[model samples]
Target: MLIAETSEGKRVNLSQLSREEITGLKKKKHYCPGCKSEIIVKNGTVIMPHFAHKKNSQCFFFSENESEEHLVGKKLIAANCEKYGIDYELEAFLPELQQRPDVLINRKIAVEFQCSPLSIARFKERTINYQAFGYQVLWILGTKLQWKDSCSSMQRQFVYLSKNIGFYVWELDISKKEIRNNYFLVSSIWKKFYQTQLFSLEKESVIDILQFPLKNHEEVSYEIASKVACEKRIHCWNQQLNQKSKSSLQLQEFFYQEGLNLRELPVEIMLPSFQSVLLKEQELIWRFQIYQRIQRDKKMSYQSLYRMLKQNFDKNYPLISDCQLIKYHLSLYLCFLLQNKLIIEKEGYYYPTNKKFTLKKTSQEFLGIPLKYGMINK
Candidate 1:
C-alpha cells in the first residue's frame, strides 16, 4: 500500500520518497488512495518505507491479512515496474469491476502478488471477475511457489495461465530480487514432473527482473527433467515390486490372470497424461477403463469416455486452473493410445487392439491392470 493521496488530492508514491520527504509526508498526513482512510508513513530502517492504514482501518481486500513478505514483494514489483517505465500504479481501483489490483500495469493488466494461501473458490471468483472486467490478471506469486523437485499437492491450486504458456508460475525470487516465469508445456503434479523442451526467461529491459537458471536453459533442464521422469518411473515400479499390500495383490491377481506381468505391458500403455492439475484418479485406472470399454463397445468416443469417468472421478476435488482436466486427460491419453497403434481410430471413434495386445479369452485381465501398467508413466 505504498501509493496514497495527499490532503490536496495529489497522488503520492511512498517508495519513491527519500527519508526527508517521508518525514515531511508524516507531518502532512496522507490518506489511502483507494479507501480514503487516513494513512501513516512508516520509515523503518529495517524495511522499505511504505504507507499503512492508521490502526484498525478496514479495507475491502482484507478477507486475508497481508504478511511482511507480501508488502515487500508488491513494493519491489511496483518499484521495478516504475524503473522499467512499465506504466503501473500500486493498488489502483478498477471502477467497472469494483475491484483493486496490487499493481495496475499499463492501466490494463492487473497484477496480484499473492504471498499467502486462499481458497480455490475465492481465487476463481477473483480471476473470473477480473476476466469479466476485460482486464488481464497476472498472479505473481511470492514465496509459496515450488519448483518441480519439491512441489506439494496443496500448492497445485495456485496454478494460472498466460497467453504463450499453457500453465505458468510467475515466481518471486525474493533474495535474488528477480521474478521467474516457469512455463510448462506438459506436466503432472502427481509425478512432481514438468515436460517443457526449455524454460527461458530473459531481461528485456534494464529493470526487467526475470532470470532463467542457465542460458539456453530449456535444453539442459529438459534433459534433466526427462532423466528424472524415467528414473522416478522405474523407481516406483521397483518399489511396487518389492512391497506387500492389497494393491500389489490385487494388481498381480488381475494382470497375472491375463498372463501379463508389469514388464510385458506396452511402453505406451502408461504414458503420462498431460497437465492433469485437478485429476485425483490415477491415469492407469481411467486408461484401463478406456481399453475395457472399447473392447466391449468396439469403439471409444470422447463423449462416452467423459460420461463414464465423470461417474467415478471426484467432482469434490479442488481445481486450481481454468482447464477441465478430466476431459483433457481422457482426450490426450486416447490420442496417445491411437498414436501408438494400441487403439485404432475410425472417424471420431477408437477401437482397442486386444488380440494384437496379446489378449486371450483363456484369462481375464485385471481391471486395475491398466492402472498398474500406467502407474509409473511419470
Candidate 2:
C-alpha cells in the first residue's frame, strides 16, 4: 500500500517522499491503516517505495503481494490525480464496506486498478457493496485482463454502460503510460468488436476522461455482418450440425422438437445486432426462437416476447449499473426485425410479415439476393 499511518496516528505517503526522506521515516514505527498492524517500509532501487505487511500477517488489505505492474499503474494514477489537483486517497480502506479501492476520488468514486484475474462472484460482491454505499466504482483493467479477438464471460463483467458510449471498458497500458477507452463494444458468435480511443496519462485527466463521453456525444457505427459473412457463418453452422457438435446438437434438438429443420430456417435468423451480446444463447438460437414464436402465434406483444426469452438473456453484467441492458437489446432486435420487413410493428405488438421466410440452397444463391439490413448504426 502507498499510504501508511504513523505511530502518532498521522497518515504518511511514502511515494511523496524522497529516497533519503523515506529512509529516515523507515526508522520510526508505522502501521497499516486497515489492520493497524506494524508494516515495514521496503525501499529498493528497482521497485517503488511502499509498505509491506509482516510475514504471516492476517490482514485482508495487505494480504496479496502486489506486482510491479500493479504498483506502477497505481503510482501513475496517483500522479495523474495530483496533476489534476483532484482530492484523492491512495489505497483508502472503507471500514463500513470492508473494501479498499486502489484510489478513492473525492470519497465518492472508487477506482480499482485490477491487474490480476478476479472471480465473477468476488467482482460482483465488491461492485454491489460499493453501489450499496452510494459509491460509484470504476474498474480499470490491466493488460493481463484485456481481451483479444473475443471477450470472455469474465471480461464482459467489466463493461460499463453510458449514454455517450453504448458499452465500454477502461484499460490501463502501463507500457505506453496511457489509458484506452474501448467503447461501443459488440459481440459476435466468434469475435468481439469495439472502437478504441487512447488518452495519454501525461496529457489527460483521469477524472475528466471518465466523463468525456457524457460531455461529448459521438456516433458509433458498426456493421454486424455482411450478407456474405452471414452466409459463411450459416454454412459453418450447417457443418457443425452435420458433425453433431455439442452446441449445434443442442440447438438442433430444439428445432426438431419444434417440428422445424435448423438448416432450413430463414436467413433472417442469422441477422446480428449490438444488443445480441446480452443473450446467453447464440444469437441465431434465440432469434429462431422468436421467429418460431411469431410464426406459431401470428402476433405477439413486445412484453410477452421479452418474458418468453428472459431465460435466454444473460443477467450477470454487474458493472453496468446504468441501464436495463436486456430490454435495451430486445428493443434493438425488434427494431432490426421491423427494419428488415421480417416483422411489422403495430400498437406495441409485432406480427410476422406476409413475405416468405426461406433459406437459399447455396451461398451463391444467398449472395444473389441484396441484403437490406447489413449494419446497425448507434
**Best model number under lDDT:** 2
Model 2, range 47-122, lDDT digits (tens) per residue?
7888899888889775458887888898899899999999999889999999999999988999999998889898
Total clashes, candidate 1? Answer: 4
Off by over 4 Å in 1: 62-68, 148-154, 161-166, 185-191, 195-202, 205-277, 282-289, 301-328, 356-378
Weakest lDDT window of 10 consecutive positions for candidate 1? 364-373
Report the C-alpha lDDT of model 1 over 162-234, residue by residue, as the tens digit.
Answer: 3223344667766666666665423432344443322222234212333221223322122122223434554
User: Can you tell me which runs of candidate 2 are displaced by over 4 Å?
Assistant: 215-218, 235-249, 261-264, 273-282, 311-314, 321-323, 358-378
After TM-score superposition, the amount by which residue 245's alpha carbon in candidate 1 deviates from its true location, in angstroms, is: 14
The most accurate candidate by TM-score is 2
